[model samples]
Every structure is written in structure tokens, then in C-alpha cells.
Target: MSTIVFLHAHPDDEASQTAGTMRLAADAGHRVVCVYATNGDHGTLPTDLAEEETIVLRRRAEAEASGQVLGTARVAWLDYADSGMTGWDQNGHEESFHAADLDEAAGRLAAILDEEDADVVVGYDWHGGYGHPDHVKVHHVARRAVELAARRPRYLEATMNRDHLRRIFRAGVEAGLFPEDEGFDPDRPADDGNPIGTPEAELHWHVDVRPVLASKRAALACHASQEDVGWMLGMPEDQYAMAFGDEWLSEPGRPEGIEDGLPF
Candidate 1:
């Protein structure tokens, strides 16, 4: 069986973007591992954190629990601090992921790729889906790691399908399920001033993950400390499935698209 490594920006990021993919790979007898770029030191303050526990500790614990729910065999952290948002002051901190040395960060991940003998590795889209600094750094570092690793694993950039999101939002608005004026706009500039995701024409793979959507939601539920997740979990089941049931990927320079399983 092949080993699949998923490199994510923060703790709950894996649950949101790749939980279903990880579970599916594990169920198929493949080794599934998750590597987080940061410990999420700058994430929203948890109201429930114990006096002895800091945000970093709480977030790491949540990530590990999330990995367990997704059937991931191993979970690793690169030990970088969270680079808050795009323009946040923390972005300039030496220990922040956004400010980490590129070669150093890539070397760390490259070592993991070599150790795991990974067959495939997944990272975020070019703009990291929504332009978060840590996420954009993930794109660069993961790609660099693939280039540096001796294993030379196949690389796939995980991304949302912008067109699909727009369509879903539009339909939801028409159905009055989502308020027409309050609905998300995928085309709007995000954290780093880039639009949400790549267009359909640029995508290479669309993996149907509805089979593991339940596991995905369960994985997300593990990060209860993140208040943002509450709104997501409260979303209507059908809407949640419609929005997350399909995981999209892009292989640079690939022209063909797959709507089923991964090449592995």
C-alpha cells in the first residue's frame, strides 16, 4: 500500500480540507499521515482552555484528536508559530511560519517525505485557498519539499472549486436556505487579496468524498476549541455535504481531470 502525506497550515485546516481524503486513503489500506506547518499559537482564544494549557497546547491536542477521527496513522507538527492573518504583526515574527526560512522549512518536510517513502503528498493551492499567510507559505514549502525529497512523490495542491461554491451559494440563496445578501462570495478578494480558489478549467482532479463525509464532520468536531467550527458544524447536513462532499486537487501542468478516485 502507498503512503499519502497531507501538509496543512494549521490544526483544524486538515479537518476542513482533507479529512475525507485522509479517511478514504486509510480505508483503502494506504498509510495516511498529517503534518501541520504550525501549532496555531495565534488562533482564536479558547474560552475553555485550562489554566495550565495554552492555545498552542490546546490546538495541538485538538489536531491529534482530529487525526485519530480521520484514521490518520501519524500526525506531525513542524513546530512553527502561527503567522496570524495576512497583515497581522505576528507575520513578521522570526518563529512564525510566514517568516520561516524557506529552505529550512522545506528541508524539514523533505525529511518526512524521505522517511515515509511517500507515494503522494498534498498541499494547499497557490494562494492557499483563501490567502492566509501560513497557508500561502504551505504551498511554497510543500512544493519545495517535494522537490527536495529523495522519494519524489506525486504532488497535488488541494483547493476549493470556486465555480462550484458560487453555484451552491446561488442555489442556496434561491431556496432561501442562505440569506441572499449574507451568503459567501467566492469571487471576492480574500485574506491576501486573491479570490478564493481556482476556476474549474484549471483543476485536475475532483475526488468524490461523500462516502467519508461523516468521518470528515467528526474530525472537524474534534476541534471544539475553535469557535468558527461551531457555525460550520451547525450548517444544514445537505448543505454541508453539498459544499464539502467533493475535494478538488490540481496537478501543475496536468490537463486531464478525474472525478472519482486519486491515481494511487
Candidate 2:
């Protein structure tokens, strides 16, 4: 069985982005392992002050449950503090993942790759799938892990094309799924303080996961703290399926001429 490693920036990233794929792969008899880069301590917390740690514990439990549903072979953590985003002053702190030693982080990830002998390593695109510093760090560390591994595992980064993203955003708007005038721009550069952007063309790999849309949504729901339940509940089933059908892989040296959009 081919061993696949999915590296995520936080506890919930796998469920939101690649849970269905992981399920598909594992069901196909492939070994799938998910690596979470942070504890996700910075995510939404309940208003109850006495249960702050309880919230973190609950989220971790949710991640485990989601992983079980996806049939993942293992769920590992890098145990780094969440580096919220660009404007967050906390991200600039010494303990933040963005400020951590890249080489040391790489070494930690490299150990996992080496131990697993993974055939494919998956992570967020250069834009970190949404320009989060922790996500970007996950991407970098995952790549470095592959580099340091003796096996030279294939790398896949989660991403989206500008054109496809626009279509999805437009569809969402037309269906009253999201705000039409939100000014969704996916072509912005990562360093320009924008959350969404078109990833580099050479590093993109598309996969059509329409068949697993329901499972994907279910997995996403597992990340209730990060996802907007109201928004998800508002969307019609078909629209939801369409929105989650396509997935992008970011990395160099994908199969040549393997189609630009998702391949079912």
C-alpha cells in the first residue's frame, strides 16, 4: 500500500480541506497519516472562562473523531503554538510558529517522513491555502521534510486556481451563499496582506472529488470551532457539493498535461 502523509497547519485543516481525499485514499487500501502542525489553541473559545482548556480538548477530540471517520492510519502533531495571521501581533512573537526556527521545524517534520516512509507528502500551497503564517510554515516544513527524507516522497500542496476560485465565489454569491460584494480576489500576492490568491501555475495539481462531497462536509463540520455553522447550514446540498468537488495540489513536477482543472 502506498503511504500518504498529509501535513496540516492546525487541527481542523485536514477536515476542512482534504478529509474526503484521505478517506478515499484510505478506503482504497492506501496508508494515510495526518500531521497537524499546531495545537490550534488560538481558535474560537467558548464564552465560559472556566472551560477554556476544555474547548481545546474538545477540538482535539473532534479531530480524532474526524480522523477515525476518514480511516486515517495515524494522527500526529507538531505541537507548535498557533500563529494566527499577518496582522495579529502575536504572530510576530518569538514563540509563534512564524518566528520559529525553520531548520528545527524541518527536522521535526523530517523525522515523521523518515519514520513513515511516505510515498506522498501533502501540505498547504505557498499561500498556505489562505495566507495564514502557520499554514505557510506547515507548507515549508512539509517540503523540507520531503527534502531531508532519503526516500524522496512526492509532494502535494493544497491550492486553488484564480479562475476556478472566481467561479466558485461567483456561484456562491449567485446562490446567496456568501456576500456578493465581499470583493473576493484570488489573484493577490501572499505578501500583500490578502488571504486568498492564485497559486503558482507550475505547482498546481487538480483532483475532482465530487463523489466524496458529503463526506467532506461531514468532516468539515467536525471543525465547528473554525467553520461557520450558519453558513454551511444555509447552503443547499447541491451547491455545497459543487463547492467542495474541486481540490488543488501545490508543488512542482506534477504529471505533465494532466488537465488544468479537477479530474474525477
Candidate 3:
């Protein structure tokens, strides 16, 4: 059986970004694992540390539930704190993922990859899918894992295409979901796009997951705290399904025999 591992920035990331693919892989009897780079402690809070702890706990539970829904065999965490986007004060905090030891982090992930004997390892693109320090770190570690493992593992990076992003943004704008002033910014690169990152054709491999879109949404709903349910309200279910029906994967050195087709 082939083993597939997804390395992500936070808890809900797996669900929102690639739940359908994971589900499809699992349904096909592959061993699937999710590795979370952080506990997602800094996402949001109720003004109390205790409350925040409760939220983190809840988010972990939600992650577990979502993993089950996607048929993931295991979930692992690097236990780092969430580092808010580029300009946020949290970016420089010593406790944030940005401050964590990159070599050590890579070693930890490498260990997981070794143990799982992963055939395919998935992570974010080079820009960290929007330059999130944690996401970037994940990409680094995933690359390291492939390098350190005894057997070479195919490293796949998750990303979107320029055309698809434009369409999604335009649709959001036309539907009044996003303000007209929301335009891409090249200077402050992180400020230019989605919470995750945009896609680049050079670094991505596209796969249509239309058959398992419903499972993807179900997995997304599992992470109630991270996602804003209201954002999905305005979009029609069919539209939502169509828009998220595809996923992208990119590896440093393309694996032989892994053709471009439905992963399942």
C-alpha cells in the first residue's frame, strides 16, 4: 500500500486545502497521514488564556474528527505556536513558529516520514502559499524529509494557478463577497492574497477532486473556529463544490509513473 503524508501549517489546513484528495486516497486503501506544523493557538481568542486554551483543545478535537472524516490513519503535530502573517507583531515573537529551530523541525518531520515510509509527501509552495512563516517552514521541512529519508519520497507542494485564483477572486467580487479595493500587492507580498497562498503553474500538479467535494466541505465544517462559515453562505452549494473540486500538487523531482490523473 502506498503511504501519503500531508504537511500543513495548522489544524484546519488539511481539511480546507486537500480533504477531498485525502479522502479519495484513503478510500482507495492508501495509508494517509497529516502532519500539522502548529497547534494553531494564535488564530483567535475570547480575551482569556483559559478560554484560548479551551479553543485550542476544541480545535484539536475538531482536527481529529475531520481526520476521521477524511479517513486519515494518523495526525501529528510539531507543537509550535501560530505565527500570524508577515506584518503582525506575533511574527517576531520568540515563541512563534518563526523562531523555532528549522533544522530541528526538519529533523522531526524527517523522522515521521522515515517511520511512515511515505511514498508521497505534500506541503505548501516555496512562497509558503502567502509567505506565512510556518507554512514556509513546512515547505522547508518537507523538502528536508525527502532528502533525509533512506528511500526517496516524492515531495508534492500544494498550490493554485494564476487563472484559477483570478476567477475565484473575480467571482467573489462579482458576488459582492470581496471589496473592489482588494487587489494584489507586490511590495507587501503576504498582503496580496488568500490566507494560504496562490498557485504557480511551474510548481504545481493539478488534480480534479470533484467526486469527493462533499467530503471536503464536511471536513472544512469540522474546523469551525478557523473558517468563517459566513464566507461560504453567499456562494451556492454547486458553485462551492465546483470551485473547490480541484487540488494541486508539486514535487521537487517529479516521481516516475505518477501520471496526471485522478489520484484515486
Give candidate 1's whole-model lDDT.
0.90
**Per-candidate total of colliding backbone pairs:** 0, 1, 3
Model 1 misplaced regions, further than 4 Å: none
Candidate with top TM-score is 1
How much is 168 displaced in model 3, in angstroms? 4.6
Residue 222, candidate 3: C-alpha displacement in angstroms: 0.5
Cand. 3 Cα-lDDT: 0.75
Candidate 1 residues 33-142, lDDT tens each? 89999998877899878889999999889998998898899999899999988888999999999999999999999999999999899998999999999999999999
Least well predicted 10-residue stretch by lDDT in candidate 2: 255-264
Off-target runs (Cα >4 Å) in candidate 2 are: 47-53, 172-179, 188-195, 199-204, 227-230, 260-264
Q: For each candidate in the order shown, give its overall lDDT on alpha carbons.
A: 0.90, 0.74, 0.75
Cα RMSD of all models vs. native, in order, equals 1.2, 3.0, 3.8
What TM-score against the true fold does each predicted structure earn?
0.97, 0.86, 0.83
Displacement of the residue 40 alpha carbon in candidate 1, Å = 0.8
